[model samples]
Target chain A: MSRIVLEGISKIFGSKQVEGVELIRQGKRKAEIAAACGAVVGLCDISFDIVEGEILTLMGLSGSGKSTLLRCMNRLVEPSCGRIMVGDVDVTRLGRKDLLAFRQKTFGMVFQHFALLPNRTILSNVGFGLELKNVPAARWNEAAMQAIELVGLKGWEAKYPHELSGGMQQRAGLARALAADAEVLLMDEAFSALDPLIRRDMQSELRDLQQKLKKTIVFVSHDLDEAVALGGRIVLMKDGEVVQIGQPEEIVARPATEYVARFVEHIDRAAVMRAGQVADRSAPVLQPTLTVAEARIRIAGEGGDAWLVADDDRRFVGCLLAARLAAARPSETVASLLEASGEAVAAESRLDALLARVAAEGCVAVVDPDGRLIGGVGSRDVVRALAAHSAESQAGDHPETSILQQTAGAERWTGASRNFPSTRSATKASTGSPTMALG
Target chain B: MLTTALVAVPPWVFIGLAALATYRIGGRKIGLLTLFGLLFLWNLRLWQATVETLVLVSLSTITALVIGIPVGIWFALSRRAWRTFSPILDMMQTLPSFVYLIPALPFFGLGAVSACFATIVFSVPPVIRLTALGIRNVPTELVEASDAFGGSTTQKLFKVQLPLALPTIMAGVNQTMMLALSMVVIAAMIGAGGLGRAVWQSIQRLEAGAGFEAGIGIVILAVILDRSTQALAARARPHGAA
Candidate 1:
């Protein structure tokens, strides 16, 4: 179930809020609405579902209403008109008192600049929400310590905010949210203030923490790299409207608009795309039950030093070496003649991870967690994928052509990757490797 | 009732306590200087006038704080309230010191009470202005943080805003006390009994020696109150782990 759902949420910030919202109903964009009424459109009919236990990023340039949308989730910035449903309760309909209690109970937020009480120690800051709720010190302290430990700040709890590093302070901010045990976290550029190396560390740690804690998080950021590193479904916003909402891979492969195309244009694809996404799913396979003579005849034209052998259910058996198959008896099954010579990589592995194995062994078998064969990645496929990306990027003169292919090639390519610029050599090399072996 | 009891206390007793509080908060050096200075006032037989001056300054400072701080907080929190009253506060501060006595003498009729009343009116502006400034200048982001975390208005005032603003507000209190002390000699013109009267009578008789002695008395009292309250402000900072 969706933990939070925002529907037709529009916020117009001016004395003419009525006219601004009416203009929105008449299907006017931000600039038109502003021109018609002296109102600034903070948000424009935004609708999106925030899945439970998922980290959804709201990304945009400054003033694109990403922060405004996040605050509206808890009514921190009251939307002009909308239905915000958190479970069964419609948050927009809540009175001030109920909204405060609901916000205290459900949402924990961290700001771009760590908004810690300067007078308070890290421990006290972590326990602040509990203190406001009148939770006894004994209980709050225990919860606070657990959260402090979770964020890897054990001995430093007694230090004031000024005493800690920016990263440490943000950890305390995170711990404060966790101590309240709130189910939803709204973090607005939580690590944007940190140095780059520390930002990366925090991003990875937060990703790990989310996996363990499973709190629904709506993170607002302008950095595409941060969104990619967060590994969540991203909601790309521009001019106070959602341009596209999808997983990083989907957005990269098919940007819904030019804005989205430019947004993901610089993303490191190898970091985001999995081997399953780039695998040659249509490659032919051999059943382990097939006889060596039958396999040789069945693969007469498909010349190769090795062949992937799988069972009837497509579960990976092993690779069949060409020499071993040729030397085997005509009645011998391919399973018996199979040699465990090649690497088997999980389908979810990244292409950067597969580069070395593909360089070492001419081909690697891609399998599911159940050891079922999905497809194979040959040196040719790797070069072809990389070449297509390089060619698209180099063809940057045509934005349309680049948008059609958003994948980024790896920076490092070896001798094996350089040889196969085309499928003809790729097919020829498969036979050539074995002939070289025999010679 | 508290001010009457404070006034009734022997001069030595009040001096001792003030010395102790200052020593505890301001450190031992200022404490020792205060003890020596008060003993010097007694040695010069100016103890009675010093006591009267102390009573006046103490009563007026307390009254100003009680009335000023809350009004200041109200002004800080409400923009319209501040906008309405800021000019009145400006007039209260800048009008002639004698203008205060014009109202005070007609209402209370020339006595120490009248002098004390005039001193309260004369000294309250700093505390109110600075207190409002202190609260108003507290970082808006911190206030926003407090609201986002569901802190109530009262809770935000006491727990977040006031504590952060204490240093500035205390500086205001110090200014108010200093103004009250300086008002004592002038207040003697309205028949108040204090070192101001000593200075005034000596001035009338053309006895520079007696006037200078009483003038020294006012200086001693000023140093004692000023250092003590300044120290109190310093101590207001909550101690935390190093």
Candidate 2:
């Protein structure tokens, strides 16, 4: 029920919205729409779901409308045309009173500047949302204390906002949102104001807090590395439109637009690329049942220190060193001479974590969640994955079609767009899947 | 009736209350000023007239604030309202202060009523202008935070805007009080009796010493009022406390 689905959300900012909205519906870009209607285009035909209990990053450069899109979810910035469905409720259709009540029950928001009330003590600031909800003072205070302790600011509750450092003030801001206990947390660049070191601390602590809390969080950021550190799907926006939406690794691996590719070009590829994604599928795998002579014949020309041996079912059996295979008598089975197994790294593990093993062993098996042998990630493959920071642009992809298809329940007719062969094939892997999962 | 009830109370009681209030809110120095300023006025035999002026200013400042603040808030919230009201406020400020008395005399005949009416008209613009300015000056992100949390309009005003705007509103209140005091002599042109009447009578009789004494009495009262309100506004700010 926490799934927030935005369908064809478009926001045009200015009194000339009727003309701007019509121009947008006619497939006008932001600049052209502004030129034609004299209204700044805020968001254009955005459709996506904020998956429950996961941090979905709205990532883009400044002025890309990521913050505006986040605000639209709670109707803080109303969309000119669209339907916003939060759980079963249509947030766009709700009246003023109903929307206020529903927002109180559903969303807790944090800001980039740590918007703590300067007049109130930390306890009162943390309990502000509850106070707005008309919660009893004693109850709100107790609940606020719990949130303050959760954020590690228990002893600082009596202090004013200005007395605390920037980092501590942000912790109090996060505690304020948590005290509301709403299901979704909308954090708009919540750490952008802090100095770099403190910003890093807040990012990791927010990730840890999200793990313990399990609240659905929609975080807006212009930093690619911060989005990757959050370990969630990225909805990369551009010029008031969603350019691409995928996991950090997937966006880095196969960016859907030239702008997105450029934005992610400088991101640390080793940290963003996953083990399964970087695995060398071209590596020859020998079966454990194969005779030693048969294995030698199968691996005659392939030059490597070891070969990953798997059973017939593709479950990884063990690594068979080249020396052992060469020294073995023709009568010995491949399984009898194999090294210990269970050395496979999970598919979801980032490539950086697998680098040490790959460098030490010269070969490491990458397995799926089921422990099935996917492929091996070797030193060369790791280097290739890191160096290949996707300079190739996804220029001809129909991003709008792919995004609509990816986020289902947007049954509106988007017309026939079969010309984009790359988009059609690229979207096929996650078609109808609930989320744009991490690779 | 209310003015008589207030005046019949012993002057020492008012003096003591003012001292305690200033001490608690404005600290020791302003508190001592309050005690001695009243004593000095009593020693000059100007205590009764000073009390009458204090009552008139208090009544008018409250009346002006009650009317001005809501109008300011409405103007700030609506661009069209601001567009319409901004010019009127400009006119109000630029118009001769004596013009307000011209209208007040026709509506409310001589004595305290006309004096109170003229002072209210003269003092209300700053309250309205500063109230709107304070609210508008609230940071955008803070307002957005409140809106995102689903705060009702009333809740946002009281909890966020009003509390943050306290210092600015207090400055406006101080200005209103000062403006009210400046009107005292002019208000004495009518039948209103107070420190203003003392100064005006001394001027008519050509008694320069009496006029100077009454003028010093008003100045002492002004200092006491300004320092106390300023301290009250300062205490409301937690940021400065740090």
Task: Pick the lDDT winner.
Answer: 2
Q: Indicate which candidate wins on TM-score.
A: 2
lDDT of 2 by residue, B92-195 (tens): 88888878788888888888999999888888888888888888988888888788888999888888888888778878888888888888888998767788
| lDDT by residue for model 1 (B93-167), tens | 899888889988888998988999999999999999999998988887677667777777888898788988887
Question: What DockQ, on C-alphas, does every prediction get?
Answer: 0.41, 0.60
**How would you encode candidate 2's per-residue C-alpha lDDT over A1-439 as one tens digit per residue?**
7999877788888798788877766667789987776889998777777779999999888999999999999999988987788899988889999999988899999999999989889999999999999999999999999999999998999998989999999999999999999999999998888998988888899999999999999999999999998888888888888877777766765567667767876898788877777776767999989899999999888877778989888999888877888899998999998887438888778888888787777788978878898888777676656544331223235443443333111111111111112222222321223331111
lDDT of each: 0.80, 0.82
Q: Which residue runs does candidate 1 get wrong by more than 4 Å?
A: A283-309, A318-346, A353-356, A359-362, A368-371, A378-401, A405-439, B1-13, B238-242
Question: Per-model i-RMS in Å?
Answer: 3.1, 1.6
Candidate 2 chain B lowest-lDDT run of ten: B233-242
Candidate 1: pairs in clash: none
Can you tell me which runs of candidate 2 are displaced by over 4 Å? A286-313, A317-342, A390-439, B1-8, B240-242
TM-score of 1: 0.86
lDDT of 2: 0.82
